[model samples]
Target: MKPKDIVLDFYKSDVLLDKKTVSELLHPEVTIDWNSSEGFIQMDYEDMMSLTDQMARAYIRSKIRISHILQEDNLVSLRFSHFVKTIENPREDMLLGNFFVIWEIKDEKLFKGFQMSHFS
Candidate 1:
């Protein structure tokens, strides 16, 4: 698949809560650099798999809405929101926050990503 298609597939998986698809689209040497209000994090493919596994359990019915998408060559960028239930008396889902991710696709898979998040 093209880089943009792969990136779209990534978001689609998140929206559908389909970790398997996400895993399959990730390159074996994938690396993700994440920056958020909490802090900055660097993770490899294995770490990503583990984190996704935990997130699947935490947000079994979560939804991710993509608001914008752009692509150039093998790079793709997207803006989105990840909705999740609140901690206190959790309901279906509320707007968790907004996030941006720029992915570099190599060999038709997600090879690297730089992402940031914010709440408003």
Candidate 2:
């Protein structure tokens, strides 16, 4: 699948809470670098799911809207805004950011991924 399509699918799966689809799209050894004020947080597939599940439980709803998408070779850069409503807060919060994800595909499956995000 095209990089854009892959990204779209990932978002769709997230919206639907489809773990299977999310797992399919992600590499088993995927490295997620969450850029934060504290430091760069890295996670592998299992840790990612653990963190995701915790966040999912805390948030009532979350969605990502892509403003721009760029692809070159195996790299895909996505600029997007995310809207999230926490169950406790019950108020929507918006975060704008750009993410760069480098994907390695093998046999039509994503074998590895490295990602970093910058907030605006």
Candidate 3:
């Protein structure tokens, strides 16, 4: 897949809760630097897998709605919002945040990322 397509598929996937998908899309040495409303966080592949497990326990389902996407070579940038249905209230989807992220695809997987987000 093209870099843009890989990143798009990653976001369109159930990445928050599915470890198998995450493993498939993320490189073994993947690393992400994220700035969110909560604070800054740096995560590696294992951290990402752990986060997926945690989200699985906390949310019933989740989705990403992309507003914009741009690609330059192996770099793909996207703007989107995340919505989730909590385990406690599975019937309603709550807006989790709005995000802007740039991903670098290497070895046909998400190798590196820089992301920023704020609460919606």
Candidate 4:
């Protein structure tokens, strides 16, 4: 699948609350640098799964709207806004963030991914 397609699928799965599909789109060795209200958090695949589970427990109603996608070879830069409502709070609290993801694809499967996100 195209890199953009993979990303769109990731967001679609996330919106559907399908963890399996989200996980399938991720590379096993993925590295994520996520900047949030708390701080800059660095994570790998295992950590990503843990975070996803936590979000699920929080039962967030989320939507990701992609503004732009730029791809060259194996690198992808995505600009998106993630809107979410925390189940516990039930308030419309949105996270506006931009992501830059670099992928290493081999044999049509993602071997590795490095991502950085900034939120405001």
Candidate 5:
């Protein structure tokens, strides 16, 4: 699959919460810059793995709804909404909010990412 397709699939995998699928799509030295209410942050592959596990444990059910996707060469940009249900109560629909992300693919794997988001 194309790198962009892999990323889209990765977002869809939020519903499944499959670590294997998530891991397989990432580059070993993946880097990420994330910005949200907490402010700007950065991460490496290990950090990404840790967050993946935490997210799986924190959200009972979740889905990423993509609004748009654009790709050029190995770079991709996407706009999406992240929706989830907490582990405490799986009924309440918590919209962690919408986001825009730019991803860089290296050797057909997701090697870098930058995200800006708003949380509710």
Candidate 6:
């Protein structure tokens, strides 16, 4: 898959439900630097997997709405919004956040990322 395709699929796929999907998408040495409404956090591959596990336990379903995506070389820039149905409120899908991220692909997996997001 193209670098952009890999990045898009990573977000669009059921990653929280399937650890194998995350394992396929993130490189072993992957790192992401994220700045959110709360604060800045840096995460490695294991951290990312842990996050997915947490989200899986908290949310019943989730979706990503991509607004824009651009790619150059191994770098991909994407803008999207996340919506989720929580386990406690499975009937309603709530807006989780809006995000803008730039990802670097290495060995056909997501190698590094710089992300910024705001909650709704």
**Could you tell me every candidate's TM-score relative to the true structure?**
0.86, 0.73, 0.95, 0.73, 0.91, 0.95
Candidate 1 residues lying further than 4 Å off, grouped into runs, are: 13-17, 85-91
Deviation from native of the Cα of residue 13 in model 1, angstroms: 5.1
Question: On residues 31-116, what C-alpha lDDT tens digit does candidate 2 reach at each position?
Answer: 66566544678777887677667767767776787777777766666666666676776775655355555555544445566666
lDDT of 4 by residue, 2-117 (tens): 77566566666254355676577668777766555567777887777777777777756767777777777766667767766677676766664555566555444444666666
Instruction: Judging by TM-score, tell me the better candidate of 2 and 6.
Output: 6
Off by over 4 Å in 5: none
The deviation in Å at residue 31 for candidate 1 is: 0.5
Residues 1-120 of candidate 3: C-alpha lDDT, one tens digit per residue: 899989987887467688898899999999999999899999999999999999888998889999999999999999999999997898998998999999999999999999999997
Give candidate 4 regions above 4 Å deviation: 13-17, 35-39, 89-93, 96-100, 104-111
What C-alpha lDDT does candidate 3 achieve relative to the native structure? 0.92
Tens digit of per-residue lDDT, candidate 6, span 20-42: 89888899999999999999999
Task: Estimate candidate 6's alpha-carbon lDDT, on a 0 to 1 scale.
Answer: 0.91
Clashing residue pairs in candidate 1 are none
Q: Comparing 1 and 6 by lDDT, which wins? A: 6
In terms of TM-score, how similar is model 6 to the real structure?
Answer: 0.95
Minimum summed lDDT over a 10-residue window in model 2 is located at 11-20
Error of 5 at 68 (Å): 1.0
Those runs of model 3 whose alpha carbons end farther than 4 Å from true positions after fitting are none
CA lDDT, every model vs. true structure: 0.82, 0.64, 0.92, 0.65, 0.85, 0.91
Clash total of candidate 3: 0
Q: Which residue pairs in candidate 3 collide?
A: none
CA lDDT, candidate 4, residue 118: 69
Give lDDT for model 5.
0.85
| lDDT of predicted model 4 | 0.65
User: Of the candidates shown, which would achieve the greatest lDDT relative to the real structure?
Assistant: 3
Root-mean-square deviation of each candidate, in angstroms?
2.4, 3.0, 1.0, 3.0, 1.5, 1.0
